[model samples]
Target: MFIRLPRKLFLFYVSVFYLIGIPVHAENNTAPTGSFKSKACMECHKKNNPLLIKDWRSSAHANTQPITDCVACHGKLHQAAASSSRRDSTCIRCHGGKKDPVVHSYTTSKHGVLMQLEKRSYDWNQPLADANYRAPGCSYCHMHKAGHNVSAGIRDDLMDKAAEKKVREQTRIACLDCHAPRYITRLFENGERMLEIGRKKVREARSLIEQSSVTFSDDELAPARAQLVKMQQHLTNVYLGVAHQSPDYQWWHGHPALDGDLLRIKGFIGELYRIKK
Candidate 1:
């Protein structure tokens, strides 16, 4: 017969081993990224708040980046306790809409919509891995594989064929845990086709912009360039839409929006030609 240790005892042994395995550095910003900072964090939190220390120790952030500690996210300056919204803001700092409207697109998705609608009723105390909420949030899918390793599920460079193929396989594996294999394959096929269509529309818009640039002065081509930006944004929306499984983004905000921008740029190109003539 196998006898299992209690969860607390298991954690205690793990923590003890962790303490022995890692070297502790003196508190200083000059040492390295997380070396000294993590040690400093562990020193205080390990005694006063061992549970938080345990969570961070087991996280990917700890192992991957040499323990991405408190200072990495919270900063060196201590302050009063923040609101509940702090965690969301911290996540958005890196994953937010700086380069793309990732958060915005998520808001338009079904998961996001449902999360917004039903988040209050959810047990906020439950760990993210439990998937206890009625609907998924940013953490649900992104952090599904590993809690602190949020980027585990996110594949960044979709343009590389090899990388894309890998992403497809990884996504299929993750989705299959909850969905049928056939359904996952169908969705992947559909999303790829939709993205291809969106890319073509963007290419057409770019071609029109290039044509306009030859004849029109910088001032005259401003509107076309502006429209191209809009087209690019729509293309991004399409990507976000497909990844998030949001039909509104894939259709209305993605494809049709790209179409509108393309046509407007074409109109500008025609206007420039007429002026040239």
Candidate 2:
């Protein structure tokens, strides 16, 4: 049987601290270390936490299936996590296996690539020790049974509703997980849109660079180049932005193209007019 690697499911909380009016408490509210499969179980989840009741009573995941309880997907709710792992063998009991396309696609992507590499090379990893040999599994996002004091993490905070909506629209995965193909497609579309806008902005600035490049020798070129450099930097930062602190992206993603364009244009102007080849 094949399994897919875990994907990032992000939710945009318009409210940074929806729990600002609330408190952050750490209680051993992990229910009896058993399954959440009964009305009693569901009630218990909501009962202990007034806020859980309020938040989930209106959640689609609450009563996702009337016949099947939350345990059907989330696993034994109150169990002591049974080891911090991303095992999905149990999940495969319901949503994975050789026939699942998500399983297939994941096995093909980088996430899956890691698993295969690890499995083949890690003779010590001859078999998955727990259902969680996979890191970052389904439960990490959806059906998450974490927290105390009746909470819904970021959902509690409030932010710009429109921005939140845009985030969701742009991200069909809805923060939990998107079906396999859809996830890839959504990413491509997002990148395409960004690249499009970025290229357009680059073009707009290129004309200015061209004009400045021609009429200026090194003296005039210095200041004009500085201005162009600033504009280029601004566009690069805006379009290729990420939250991570990584140079892999800065040189490869953010700067290469911009720098290349500038050098090429500068060379062209100088040579075409013999300003300073």
**Predicted structure with the largest TM-score when compared to the true one:** 1
Worst 10 residues of 2 by lDDT: 148-157
Clashing pairs in 1: none
Residue-wise C-alpha lDDT for candidate 2, range 1-277, written one tens digit per residue: 1232222111223243544423432334423654455566657656566665455555544444653334554455655333322344544565568445334434444445555566433332222222323333333333244321111222221212223333334333323342466655665455445544655646655676667655666665564456456546544442323211123333354556555555665665556457444
Q: What pairs collide in candidate 2?
A: 14-158, 14-159, 15-157, 15-158, 15-159, 18-156, 18-157, 86-132, 87-131, 87-132
Off by over 4 Å in 1: 1-101, 121-133, 147-149, 152-163
How much lDDT does candidate 1 score?
Answer: 0.67
Off by over 4 Å in 2: 1-36, 49-68, 74-77, 81-86, 115-135, 141-277
Clashes found in each candidate (C-alpha, N, C closer than 3 A): 0, 10
Cα distance off (Å), candidate 1, residue 151 = 3.7
Candidate with best lDDT? 1
